[model samples]
Target: MNSTFMLDGEEVPFTPGQTVMQAAAAAGKYIPHLCWHPDFAAHGSCKLCTVKIGGRFATACTVRAAAGQEVDNHTPELTHKRRTLLQLLFVEGNHFCPSCEKSGDCALQATAYEMGMLTPHFDHFFPDRPVDASHPDVLLEFNRCIMCELCVRASREVDGKDVFALSGRGTGSHLIVNSESGRLADTDFAATDRAAAVCPVGVILKKRVGFAIPIGKRTYDIAPISAQPAGDPDTGNKLEETP
Candidate 1:
């Protein structure tokens, strides 16, 4: 028998070395998250997956699961916190969803909707990040970046390109290209790279193929992010085809 933990009053089974998020995902339970991807190591940057375990708060993605542990998720307090975080993310970036190509398919947008973030409660930063259209095949819009570091990790760990890195500190932090020219065209990044496909927002977009899929017919349009199966990497664009 596998070791089990209680999540929202339901028993979720887990093997040794699995985190709370991993176990809950394996049990088909949805814990709202933006920075926790099964393909990568636990980052614990986004606190949206923070759950109360044994009366202490912890990030589900990094907290290892133990037998007979009780986890409190989906409570009013946690939901409110998640909504605040979403609102902050929305305001920090110029996430004008209606004008964005990744509007419907964006994990950040979908997760915001899931958390019922109707309006950006905080003041908008409106950072003057310029759009990089230097790459012949890809577009780099830094305004929509949430500092998740998915692209940074994918480029280094998977593609071995080291094409992306986070620069600056605190609120000034932003994504930067590896090239001295500070442009995507100067780097060896291709459309087929893992970093190209790993962005959860509208930051790294392919050129000339915007709006290929109608807004209403996209991934999150058909089903909410909470309904997506855990561990699935599909980000709603459906641009990549399975071989």
Candidate 2:
């Protein structure tokens, strides 16, 4: 018999070794998350994908789905928690949405909209993060990084380049370049490297081109993020993320 579990009162089938978030995402179900990237080992740091399984809270990104289990997602209680988390993220970063090139296509912005976060409930931190325009072909906007570490995982796993890492803890945690100079240009990072790409925020941006795509015509503009496919249908389980 196929393994199955209940998510938000709906039966979700899962293949062995798949986490709750992976199965849910693959099955057209949405669970809020940021740190969980495909192919890389799951990082449950974000806690945005937290779900209640058997009445206990757990991060769906790291929890393996077992048969006959009930997982609570899309609940009123959970929605409020997600909203608070979103608000925290907004305040933690200098995310000037109107001015950011990633405004429309940004997963952070899109997820906020989906969660109905009308405004940031907390005061903005406006942390004094610096921008690295040292790389000839790429820009690093440190202020916008939420420390999801997608770039870190993609670099080490896919590109085989340890280009990035997170430094500090709690509020001080931030993305760092794996170079003595602590700049992206000082590293052997190229535009083609996955570490130089796959940033869900404005942290890793292509140089010389900003707002090339109109706001209304961007990736998350036409479709809600949760409704979008996490993996390519033609690639046979291949995920959209790479280094």
Candidate 3:
């Protein structure tokens, strides 16, 4: 074991391989992040959990802390940058929250409200993305993906199934599923797979639960994310907020 260090002004002991976000979460300080789930391997690709390490901004999900290192949890500079980052995520992908099923309990929606982002400063890309509803019990709308890699990580690490992968290059990059099948229904995907359940947006949804809970009583309707509490350990942090 390595030791404890200053995490958001609190000392939390951690092993050598654990990331800063894990340490913070272990200490009960919830830092908003989309890609860095506790059950999956940390990708640090979202750039949403950028925290002040030393004096500069670094992704907390990947950065391992050394002993005596100081981590600033809350700062105006970090908040400004995070808000801008959320804006980019909002406009880059096709996040049509209104028509989607994962509206209230969506992590992206929750994080945006928590960060106090009122508007997206950039122009919407409106990428003509495709949707794959071929699976029997699941629908995948690639248009809403934020590239947080939660599904990817869960598939490989947790489920031991490498079903999804990111392809293309640069600004045109997007997610591709299965072995060039192009359609999710063509793959050996089950309704209970980790990838299907790990999606944080409308990108992936269960067909049976589309309108089961109704809109008015939905997760977001009951709480605007900021008011919601951190996830419990048992539920894998699956939007278990009280109404």
Candidate 4:
């Protein structure tokens, strides 16, 4: 028998060395997260997955699962905190979701909806980040970047491209292309690269196919993200048509 832990009053089984998020995912329990992917190492930057373990808060993606431990997830307090975090992410970036190409299929947008974030509580930063359309095959819309570093990690570890990187600190942090010309065209990034596909928001978008899938017919459009099973971990948002 596998070791088990309590999550939201239910038992979730886990193997040795699996994190709480991994175990919960394996058990078909959804833990709201933005920066975690099953294919990559846990980078606990996005604290949306913070859960209470024996009365203390910890990021589920980073905390290892242990037998008989009580994990509190989807509680009122944690839900409020997650809503605040999602609100901050919304206000920090110029996210015009109604007009964004990634509207219905966006993980961030879907998660925000799941958390019931009605409005951005904080004042909008409205930072003037320019779009990079230098690349012929891809469009770099910096306005929607949540600084999750999923693209950066995917590019380096999986695709071996080293094409994307995060620069700056704190509130000033932003994504940048790894090239002398400071443009996506200067790097070896392609439309099919993992980096191009890992953005949970509308940041790294492919060109010429913006509205290929109608807004109401996309991934999250058919089903709320929480209803989707945790087994398929590609991009966290199902944008590609698997044939």
Model 1 C-alpha lDDT per residue in residues 2-95, reported as the tens digit of each score = 9899999999999999999999888889998888889999999989999999999999999999999999999989999999999988888789
lDDT of 4 by residue, 38-61 (tens): 889999998999999999999999
TM-score of 2: 0.92
Per-prediction count of colliding residue pairs? 0, 1, 1, 0
Tens digits of per-residue lDDT for model 2, 53-127: 999999998999999989999998998999999999999989999888777678888889889999998999889
Ranking by lDDT: 1, 4, 2, 3
- How large is the C-alpha RMSD of every model relative to the true structure? 1.6, 3.8, 3.3, 1.5
lDDT value, residue 98 of candidate 2? 89
Can you list the residue pairs that collide in candidate 1?
none
The Cα local distance difference test for each model comes to 0.89, 0.82, 0.75, 0.88
- For 173-241, candidate 3 gives per-residue lDDT tens digits of 899887666888777777677777777676777775566566667665776554445433222224322
Quality of model 4 by C-alpha lDDT:
0.88
Better of 1 and 4 by TM-score: 1
TM-score of predicted model 1? Answer: 0.97
lDDT of 1: 0.89
Candidate 3: 10-residue stretch with minimal lDDT: 233-242
By summed lDDT, the worst window of 10 consecutive residues in model 4 runs over: 234-243
Q: What TM-score would every model get versus the actual structure?
A: 0.97, 0.92, 0.87, 0.96
